[model samples]
Target: MGPKVIAFFLPRPPNYPMPFVDVGDDILLDILALCDVYTVIAVSAIDKRLHALTQTKQLWLSLIQDSTFRHVLELRPPNNLELQLHSTRELVDLIKRAVIGPPPWWPGGPSSSRTPSYTIAFNTGLEIIHDYRLLPGARYMALRGASAVGKDLVMYEVWTGRCVWGIAKRTLTRFAIDVVPGGTTARVLLALPTAYVGGGYHLYVEEVDFITGTSSEVFRLGFATRLKSLIAIVGEFLLYSLPSSDAEEKQVLVNWRKSTYVVLNYGTETNSSAILIPGYIVASHPDTSPPYQQLFTVTELDAFAPHWQPLTTISLSGQLFPSTIPITTQERLEYKGRPLGEFMRTHVRLSITPSAVYRGASTVMVYVNEFPKPRPTPTLTAQMGAFFRGRRQPEESARAALLTYWLKPPGQACGLRLVSAQLATPSFNTSPLTPPRAVLEHSGSSFTVSYYQ
Candidate 1:
């Protein structure tokens, strides 16, 4: 007791928080993986060691597998090889760009606050890009182009711009692609054109697995004078066009999986164009009188043949253009001495984001160009014909409107947006009649309108 009393009283040192930098690297990585990209970036600034630790490849790779964020980005699984080629910082930056909009400092950022948009270009390994298409949900893109070696049909991950699957051939080919429901893979129908020994061209349709990269000949059509337009691959069916022996264009609906085909013949309608939607094939043709645009639908794939069912016919004369704009200009334009109204034409361009899950329903964008009635004079007729054929630019008087129909969406009404009447011709460099297109991006949440000249 005496010894204890003699000892001077000493105050215990106050407890303080441990420095974050003292945490083990493994624990730090685990913590960062649970955080959003911004949190990780903020933590990195606390200490030099943390700055390096936050850049760990393992940390960013784990973040990419986060399911909630993946859905938001509409991300397709990145190729394992391509995934490793990018640095941790670049991967983090990509997540940031996808989650939040592009950096405000970007030179050409989003065009509008409501609709964020930016452009990124990656090498496609083609000398000339013939055509490119984004599969439904915009997770993947298909491209066909000419290369110095020959031709290339390729598919890429839209976000990373990495070629996931591709083939180079010595012959020209056409491709139609569709996602396989799961995000990791796709089904591609390739049309190969070859010279038949007898006379006309032979078309061999091959089905390819995007994951395995193996292909098999699904079917072949002989005596095709021209390569059919491979419009789309909807489920197990393929919608395309073939020229019949009678010199008439036949729209074909083929169940490539079943090895059976049906002709989408709207009897005597030579001007019809068809596009495949989820549960329907939408066909549009002009009506005989007063020149109305008619839309027809063919039901989903069935065990037997499907026939076209009339949907509705709409007149653009009074709806799109006002009564003041004459159907036939005052220049006394006549077709065979008859008023040119009889020669009026409606050109339809159809686009669809085929998956219904992303948008609550499938959305079909029907873009119609209502051309002025043509005069029978060889000069005027040829000029008007050239525009429709995509050989010349659309005239100032041509009218266009975008009609969006949400198939089977509960309680939602369809809407139409009128595009500018002074349609600026998209420069294809090779073709003048290519229409302005609205591309659905990032799982139907946003879209960008693009024009090519």
Candidate 2:
């Protein structure tokens, strides 16, 4: 037979159809290395072996380099495959980098960087919104706010999940918090009798008195009233003292100030002044600074009763202290005296502007949002590909049937699908054999990914 005829009739490679000579294994591996994750993910989805192969550093690095899937690896974080990567030392080193910075949470602990805890705020106004069934007995709920909220009313709601309190105070109240009757000014407290669960949490409130115009007397409600929500201790309020319509001139205070607060300890007590709560610290009113500057308050309000893992929610609000003042720098220093840092352990000076919106009786608006920005993703470098291939020249035949079946014809480009194949059977290019395929079982240190025909 002539050379052309001899080549045409010679049994074509085992995995190839008659029209094409086999392509090279090097090209096959290169194609896979070049494939973006969308394609790899789909291809891997087609076969178990392919799926395992997708986890390889080279393949992974390939997918990451593809602009489309890079964020998935970085954003989703620490995949299970990473555990199997056998690069535990590298992982540990990355976690170690986190320990050096002040964490997103308070009073720093070791190694919290890798697995940061979230600090989501629980809001007031009617009603506990969720059941939060995922929480265990050990994790507790904390109600954080400035005083005069019918915290007691809120406590009632916290315990019963019932809407029993009334709304007498508007959105703004002053004095920092409510105190026990005549006990003290600004002394907000929740006297719950239940055995505490999961250690406990703190509660702040607004306090007002009937002394009148002495400090802040212009604002006075004729009737004594109180508002509440969270179905219980989780809502807001308005407390008013009533004046006899036909008889007497009632005495009252114009400006209200913070007196006391309620909080608890888990090994140690967390300082619950305006500072510790991230939003409050940044948004405090100017005149309301100093008292907060000092040892804010010494109260441990643990409400966990033993064995009581009750399905609960609480509502809260402040007394809408009659005074109004703009948030100011001098006021910040008044409460945070000296440098803000030195007194942090002693005072709640860290304040941020509140981002939530509420219609209020006070002239000013409060905003409570301060969400953290999402972290940026890391990109895979081409050098990583070279490092990956170094491990495996790595293997046997590229003629496996499914790979052969799904293999394309050259127009396919960068996308979720495989780019086309050069009809030349993959194994043929590098092989000296009349047909193509590597006889060896393993490749190199990188391991093999053989799929059944």
**Whose lDDT is greatest here?**
1
Please give, for residues 1-453, the per-residue lDDT of candidate 1 as tens digits: 355555687765578665665778898889888875557778889988898888799888877666434533444444457667888878777666554433433323344523333233543343556676666545566666634224387666555445566677646556677665544656666666555553434445565565565666665553343434777886667777655455244666666565555555432334556676555555554443453344433333431343322212211122111122112111221223332212235455555543212332444555555566554445878878887988955444655444455454223333222222233222221232322122433322222322110
In candidate 1, residue 153 scores what lDDT? 77
Tens digits of per-residue lDDT for model 2, 1-453: 666643445665798654312545344446776654345556668666556555555544443333222211111123455545544345334323322223333223344323323232224432332112110110112222312345422211111122222223222222222222112122232222123453222222333231220122222222222212111111122121222232221111111122222111111112222322111111222122443332211110111112112112211122122032111112222111232211222212221111111111001111111112334443466447757778422332222111011111212222012212222333332322111111112222111111110
Evaluated against the true structure, the overall lDDT of model 1 is 0.51
Q: After superposition, how far is residue 416 of candidate 2 from its true place, in Å?
A: 55
Q: All candidates' lDDT scores? A: 0.51, 0.25
- For candidate 2, the 10 contiguous residues with the lowest summed lDDT are 354-363
Off by over 4 Å in 1: 1-134, 143-151, 158-163, 196-226, 244-248, 267-271, 288-293, 296-298, 303-344, 354-360, 374-399, 409-453
Which residue pairs come into collision in candidate 1?
426-452, 426-453, 427-452, 427-453, 428-453, 429-453
At residue 72, candidate 1 shows an lDDT of 34
On TM-score, the candidate that comes out on top is 1
Alpha carbon RMSD to native, model 2: 33.3
Off-target runs (Cα >4 Å) in candidate 2 are 1-77, 101-293, 296-299, 303-348, 351-453
